[model samples]
Target chain A: MSHMEFTGKTVRDAIAKACEELEVDEALLDVEVLEESARGFLGLVGHRNARVRVRKRDVLKEVLEVERPDSRYTNIKPQEFSEIESFSKSGLEDGKITQEGALSENIDKSEIVSQAKEFLEGILCRIPVEAAVEVSVVNGSIELEITGDRSGLLIGKRGQTLDALQYILNKSINRETPLEEKTEIIVDTEDYRRRKQEILRDMALRMSQKAKKSLMPAALNPMPANERRIIHMILSEDKEVYTKSYGEGPLRRIIVYPRKAMPNKRRRR
Target chain B: MKELVEFIAKSLVDYPDEVNVSEKETEIGLILELNVAQSDLGRIIGKHGRTAKAIRTVLNSASTKRKQKVSLEIIE
Candidate 1:
């Protein structure tokens, strides 16, 4: 079939129009954005609509692929999304944000920072450690950095203790709030978290490479929820490999399966 | 310690019959060696070694109160 073009005030509108014309669901349409809609000049002058090419998607190909390209958040009603709701990242590097600054203008940064700092200090004093909690707002998340001579003990084995502290801080801050109102809290100590992130990113790439070479799934060591998420995030885009976490909680681990190899996985054909 | 790891490994893997544990006295403490089926390695080790680390952490903590030093070696 030949490509058909559609135009509307914006890309989403154009896609909607195309779907209406074809009498097919939006997911079935393979859209290639030819030109993004422009508001142009003010809200009036030189304004132009978005134009896109459309075709039918291959159902079998779509199902066999490891990850959904970018179907999240499309169907959500605008009213359901709050101002502070975190942006769902579509492009890996670009993320989903149209803004480079703080998420919401109404959010009081100083108040939240102080509250987080106070909460952390309350716990630190109770422990035998001499660590000082340093709090600040970076991007949209509240970062709590603990510093001291004995701070290493706070890290615990594999940053489990640190992760627990961060989890508690996030839960306490977001206790009464709804889903969209939840804030991101990051707890760090002595550069350990940052270094671990780099190591995990590297391992994901290396293991994916191994999976591709050997046509076998490369299983990583069991990891905490947060750490597993990092690896999953990095490898989600790999076309040659498919990643999935196996086993149960605490022991849950990821296996990077090479795309072409068949393991007789049970499925309805 | 050997029995403790054995029970945990046997319960975690698909091939429970293949689970095995051995012990040896070392300078640092008592060493418990764990063995599991090749296919069940992922379940035992867990993502990024978090599962293994968790198992080791449990062993160390449990043995510490008894004034015993313990380490685990997982063989695939």
Candidate 2:
């Protein structure tokens, strides 16, 4: 962390200078205005004093390494998921799968196998039969398409079970990624996750159209905030339909209403 | 107001046995008081009072349908 004191006409200009000097993202830094810039009647002198707490990104690299021992794995790309999915699907169709197939196949097939194995083990640990679960990383994220037999446990308890697994994996993987390129982890099961995203996107589009046609408000079934964000992002540009989130918690839903209807009223209120 | 309070309390509280509602209908509007088991209060309130506000919003919407004014109060 570095602190800089500077004088400028405006806070923005002073921050810009500090950012240039610190080489950090301005949004990430904490800024406080010590004193407002003053102007003299003669226009010869105006004094402004500002204190900026600059975040040094490099310092984070050191701290993150300490936080995540396996920081070397990061920057997994989205395209890799598709490739792994296809590879596993083709391999399964071909009727030839190795004990551990291609990296992509391994990544895609691992979760289902693991969940099934865990379930069976929990039930049959006392029995003679033994269950095994193994997962390989192909392009760092599991491919949804190639994954198989996950609809059962993956969709358990209204997706609470899946969400828990995803949360754990994401935390672990994010920690595994190196500090230089640390990123959030995203986990998927079967093609359900992608399909859900598509469904939400389509619903947003349909609701936008419906709101336009009927000139009425349409309330969608409640969903988590992430899903709501997806809908909001998709229809944000529409001229006719405006979106508002309603309800609460995991079941919180989105309302698509005609922009012309009750334009001035706050949606939640 | 009493009916509305009963409906809300019955729906929100997990321990329906302990659900209770008291109503005071004033000249201007209706005030509905809600009480439930301590264990079930969090479920009714939800994170940041979002669930409670949502329930109130729904109540408000329904109130409009009847052309009557009513408010909800959740007793801690």
Candidate 3:
């Protein structure tokens, strides 16, 4: 079996049970603590057992082989899968710091790129999408481009889906390395991200010009935070206009205001 | 407040039964610790913790009416 669940009085005991049943040492299995044991009043009335899920380091390869005869599984080892999983889970928090640390420590970038490709492939498999990842380094950022038939679906509406995929890949890679090194991961599908950036930059320019011509703040349509950032960054250097975000939650939109209005706003404040 | 967090978390995670939200009163305000099944952790946290941040935004708005400070922590 690739993985099994075990329960005991405590997490440690649960892990021990898994190791014993699997006939392997602790190092051979990746442990995921599911629940912490609870002790009731008087230490005798009620108590809850701890739960854990353990998976063998090598079983993943075997399982993947049996489940899918695809050639993609040939290159990925089981140990790498488990390692990536554990680190990605823990690496969810403070991802920025972890990424920076991983980069500075001289962690191999090629290894990270391959692992990220594998991780993306795993997600694409779930969606039943057929795609191949091409890795290249551009301007110091590792870009993994997904190319295949169903790439449009992966890009999703306004590239929101691509953003989600990239976020997961970055987190997984950052988790795989030591915290002292930093790595920059950029995920693109058929150059969709690049094209979208160009579109946004053009829109930002157009809106800023309108704002300056009308001598009034121009509010753009609501967009995701990242897209909004692109607009803000593009206009930030312009002498005629500046951008500010207004509204709440996901519906927040950016308002490009003329630079000449800045002094009046400060005076009112 | 705890129930709100629990409800939002449960809706996001795959294993609703394994999702737990506990509240502790702190000197600064209320601290809500969220725990979820290992497999469902990413879903609850979302891409770059955006889902978690959105949940906190909703929590802040809800708690503001009570005039009480509140914060959330996703405990791994």
Whole-model Cα lDDT per candidate? 0.68, 0.53, 0.68
Model-by-model DockQ, in order: 0.02, 0.01, 0.01
Worst 10 residues of 1 chain A by lDDT: A82-91
Regarding DockQ, does 1 or 3 come out ahead? 1
Return the top candidate by TM-score.
Answer: 3
TM-score per model over all chains: 0.47, 0.34, 0.48
Q: Write the per-residue lDDT of candidate 3 for residues A1-269, one digit (tens) a residue.
A: 23578899999999999889889999988898878999877788777899888877765334434232223322333323323333333455433343344345453467666766776676555444667888887644688888884536666556656775666555545543444454668888777888899999999999988988877668899886567767766775675665655555566677777755423311112
Please give the range of 10 consecutive residues that has the lowest summed lDDT in model 2 chain B: B3-12
**Residue-wise C-alpha lDDT for candidate 1, range B1-76, written one tens digit per residue:** 6665665565456797999888989898898888888998887786567567656754553464346888899986
Which segments of model 1 are wrong by more than 4 Å?
A: A1-106, A260-269, B1-76
Clashing residue pairs, candidate 1?
A221-B46, A221-B47, A221-B48, A221-B49, A222-B46, A222-B47, A222-B49, A222-B50, A223-B47, A253-B47
* lDDT, residue A244, candidate 2: 56
Candidate 3: what's its TM-score on chain B? 0.96
Ranking by lDDT: 1, 3, 2
Candidate that scores best on DockQ = 1
Q: Residue A132, candidate 1: how far off, in angstroms?
A: 2.1
For the second chain of model 2, what is the TM-score against the true structure's chain B? 0.82
Model 2, position B14, has a per-residue lDDT of 61
